[model samples]
Target: MTTPETFADLQIHPAVLQAVTDVGYETPSPIQAATIPALMAGSDVVGLAQTGTGKTAAFAIPILSRIDTDNRQTQALVLAPTRELALQVAEAFSRYGAHLKVNVLPIYGGSSYVPQLAGLKRGAQVVVGTPGRVIDHLDKGSLDLSHLDYLVLDEADEMLQMGFAEDVERILADTPEYKQVALFSATMPPAIKKITAKYLHDPVEVTVKSKTQTAENITQRYFQVSYPRKMDALTRLLEVEEGDAMIVFVRTKQATEEVAEKLRARGFAAAAINGDIPQAVRERTISQLKDGTIDILVATDVAARGLDVERISHVVNFDIPHDPESYVHRIGRTGRAGRSGTALLFVTPRERHLLASIERVTRQKLVEGQLPSVEDVNAQRVEKFRDSITDALNAPGFDTFRQLVESYERDNDVPMADIAAALAVLSRDGAEFLMTEPPPEKKRERPDRPERERPARKVRDDLATYRIAVGKRHKVLPGAIVGAIANEGGLHRSDFGHIDIKVDHSLVELPARLPKEAWKKLENTRIQGILIDLKLERGGRSKSDKFDKGDKSERSGKFKPSGGKPFRPKQ
Candidate 1:
């Protein structure tokens, strides 16, 4: 694989070699150059490469080449640590095998099982699944791996941290002995090191180190915004960050398009780059970027390679790149040679762990950048607008424009101030650019229940109470109960009265003489996608049911019961 500079030098099928050329990859990265030959030789490999260094393709190409399409069995298995990473790796496989019509299935938690089971039934050759779900399928007799040819463990260290080690071993135990084993990780922790030592047979190791950024010319900085208002902070930063050109990186293609479209809509020239774009269009877009037709390029990791723009003055990760190596390559895009450049990274409350990783890699703490207010963007815009007007007034061609303005002033009898204000009006963005208002404050949450429960007001003396098995958090407005009764129970709205929502249950007023069939219908009806359950409400059952006391949920059904979680609907 290291014999020549191009991917064609590798001992791969001609079709795969041609596909690599079609994607415009002229040189192999370090990991690709080293690990690929060993894999193609049918030897096991454990690749130690950082994120964003073409690790996906390193194992992907070999797996695709070795898979036998005529054999209708699961020939390849790729296990990722997280669902997001699993989906991302499966997408890479699909994109690389677009001409091959290879069927790759990505199975993970969070999604339903029916579609996945269906894909498996259709004779998919490559099965990518999380460890826990993969183990579940193996136990269920659905995921047959007796015919597996290549087994890849991607991000092995992460899977162990997420507590998937037991499941990983169980799944690996079922693979055929002759299968080629490949493991890739950012770091070789003790656990993964042990697993590789036991399972791999004379595996060749390849490590690709990311070029350090502090050694380069880039100056890195970070700003800590509180949990609620990061969007406003990014907007304020973008206005001041503007220069000849820039590349803003987000986590996904949808985000790239969204942030880019918003920037363009706000009058800055911005465009997005991602893998979905056709090769011809992506090349043309990159060409336009170099020719000064585009001022800003918003992109994701895999799409922004081979970018060498002299005009790029800044790089913004609108969202933090997935790993520290990604962070280095992103900032490295700017600050070439001895040129000074700036990098602004955005992090959220939950992602502070990732920030810590970046600091460790760079060996320097990132200085926080101040969040700009609305006045900041307006001041910059007004300064530029005024400069533009001054330049036009001083131009050699100003005499003609001045004559036209003066002619209008004389003929229309308009005051000069009025004319100037009119001209400014046509240029202002809704005339509020100068009237700076701070971004809207997030809503302060009010306590859901009263500090002290009110004394039970008797709707019927010595009456029976029924539990609705739902609560305030379900958006169960009082009108829903009133209408459900009036429509289904053949009663007027006045037939029902006061309703109460407790920590996990609710109570509603109903006539004592309600019939059994109607009550059964009421109990079975699903209100807002939640099945209604009618039961006796006891004044002391809250204490008996351990309503806020234990880890056990009130309803433990087929899936893990989520008590009082917010409602999510299918799109």
Candidate 2:
């Protein structure tokens, strides 16, 4: 058997091949290119590849190619380490063979078992199940693998780590001897290699080149925001961005639909692509996106693969991806064909370390992106309104509309500007108007500060500074910041001033010499999903830079400034 370079080069069934063509898979992986030919010819295979390298498809292609659609009994079995991975693999099977009309089911714990038993009784051509759930089905006689011709051990190392190795071994023992065994693992640890030596017979070996993740062309960016203000931030982003198309990625399918619904409710052309969509409907939604009928697509990582719409110039990770490779793939949906694209990741306070891990993996700094100013959003909205009016006036029947407006104005004793203002107010969809004045182009007259001027202090050097990890995106009001310090940080409202919140961080001024007990209490508390981060102030930097590494409050050296006592809040 020879290696396959493309999906067509493999001996996949005509139906599955058609499905692949529909799903946009052109090239196969190095492992897939190497192992497909042998597996299609009924030889066992042992493939070693790192995570997020498309290892699922290397074996899936061959097994689906070999399954007998007419028999309907299970002909292929895939064992996964976790329920999430199991469902993800099962979805891949369905998406690749939906046009072929094959039934694929994923069995796992923490989900209803009756549906799985019923699905197996209905004759599944392929079954992907986690260990405990699979064994449960096996004992109940609801699942039969006697006729199985192919078996897949995916992420075997993870399964063993999760204490599923014994169950997997038992499953392998129960599977028919003539079955083709395809084992894939990221590492060849002794236990895994021993299982490989025992279960697979002189298997063809294939290892895909694990490319350097550090070289991924992802321009990672994060906006520090609180949970409550996330929707507002996202809406503001949608209002100002000029992407050709965008996909907002979330962690869950429900999140995909929820975010999509919110965007649609705001009148954007958006849709959700998830596991729950019917195959035909999903194809329709994708076709619309590819052709520009849709502008924003909300999808999970697994549901978004092969979504190679070249017009997609933006990828918004509504939540940070679980792993760096996933970040690569999610953003990889954009930035294709040598075009520059933008990827914005939303990082919660707890998820900052995850962002750091991604940076360490990819070796890139995700520059911080500012949440669009209310002025920016208002400008965009006004421009859009102008464009809409322009479109209407440019139409053939606008002369009639003009005449009607003139007549109404004459009869109603209204000035044209008044009518226009009314229309503008009517056009707004109950959103609050931004009334703050933009700064003048040139500097206005102001008193010059001394070159040696000290930073502003609250109440004659009674000021102390506390860093909070929250910012504008959390919908945290200035009053909330003030109150948190007053009630929680044990400072009076008059003792705080010059509050500022950048996208990922916030800062407030507090009395320098807080009561000893109050300072001690403030040191350990968090506020509004952010660490209170109360500490003495020394320097000034960008709001983002100030808390970039978090606050520097320590236990021993920590004290009130100017020989004052440590402040502590009461119980």
Candidate 3:
């Protein structure tokens, strides 16, 4: 198949083409080049591409081009997995269809439904929503799909994984029989294949394979450290690395703000971009990053998509992503436009398996490296200090300041050298001139040591165990539990301890002195649609007295837990 050189080459409507140009899209991506024509030809399409491949516009442009502005009935419906993604898609459609005068409405949970009802009443031409809420509207008969001419499923695999397959099927069943359907997924699993076979008719398949060869100009490295030491290590690296701009990728929205605030407190020009920030402010933050006002940006994966800045010279993975594809996408923000960039991955000891998985997928071994030493940080600081003085001397308006300083020196009968020394001290303020000493390393068993002779692990005196109401019965996994708590409580994954899952309850260890606010939030948090009802476990007895006394053996490493599971620390 021949590739289209630009959006215009695809023969899109002039109005939509002008909108695309206004949005600064010069050329179509591979997916856009392949899928746009098929979609515009009134054929069902199956798009296979990864994130950040410009898939939104591939479908949006065609839908906008084909919409009948005179007919206000809903002509197209797009379903996404998350509210953030749904809003993002809606924004894209609005941007690309601005000149076409098409009305696009985004309906999702957590927002008032009044606006959605009003939009439907006004006869919106396009609707974008999540599957569950879409089903809710369909059940209420408030949403009309009889006139819907096109249905597009964005992130089909993610929707299915979020347990929305049945909802998707039911929603599809409500639409007209002749309505065109399009499915876009990052990976085509068996479930997705089944859906395609059932819903689509001779769909035009377009697969855009990701570039397997990792960016040759990008240097990749990894550092092994515990969770408590991550902030210090990151600060040291920031001091030494020579980058015009850097992006730090964390796992949660809360972490983004916390990390950015901490960095700013430590004297770095940093800000955060997350879902909570208003769209206008997010754009302003990006503008600041581009213009060199903000040197560091801490962001989550969802908020950082489509972020293209030529000044981004480094990408730091503050927390490892859950999947290899996400890791690739996070690092892909750098090393763009044929420029060299640096990618740093922070891995705990227990997360080595994830590190290996990333290497296996990327087909490149990352170089193991140590954090910058205190001496290195001090040296860099001294260099920066000298450069600042040199710049001040070369500045055009320094004569007035120099005369003032000289006058002060003369009035106080102070020598010029002493005056300079005093001024330098004032400039330094109370900030530390050197980095703190590195934390002591934890000891581990040697490969040659006999199993019986190895030392027993030391018990943590600072941690306290708590019992939660939901467990194996609710189909909760260790990762899910950890993720929920860490994300909601603003704690790191490594902050968790042993997680013992029982038939109806689970025991999780966490820091004993949690903040009152975090404790309250944990009490109200839910897992798998079940309320946590978290309570402190005192002397092997829960506050509710639900746990069996005999389970003490299981908790103390005597009798093995279910499935012969040994006690393993949380990653």
All candidates' TM-scores? 0.61, 0.66, 0.75
lDDT of 1 by residue, 313-425 (tens): 77887777656877888888888777777788877655688899988887778887777666776665565556557666677978886788899999999998898878766
Give the 10-residue window scoring lowest on summed lDDT in candidate 2.
Answer: 550-559
Using lDDT as the yardstick, the better of models 1 and 3 is: 3
Choose 1 or 2, whichever is better by lDDT: 2
Cα RMSD (angstroms) for every candidate in the order listed: 16.0, 17.4, 11.4
Ranking by TM-score: 3, 2, 1
Candidate 3 lDDT by residue in tens digits, 65-131: 9889899889999998767678889989889988877889988754567999999889889999977
Q: Rate the local accuracy (lDDT) of all candidates.
A: 0.69, 0.70, 0.78
Native-to-model Cα distance after best TM-score fit, residue 166 in candidate 1, in Å: 3.2
TM-score of 1: 0.61
| Candidate with maximal lDDT | 3
Collision pairs in model 1: none
Q: On a 0 to 1 TM-score scale, where does candidate 3 land against the true structure? A: 0.75
Candidate 2 at 543: error in angstroms?
A: 27
Q: How much is 266 displaced in model 1, in angstroms? A: 4.8
Where is model 3 more than 4 Å wrong at Cα? 1-6, 24-27, 212-214, 335-337, 389-422, 441-571
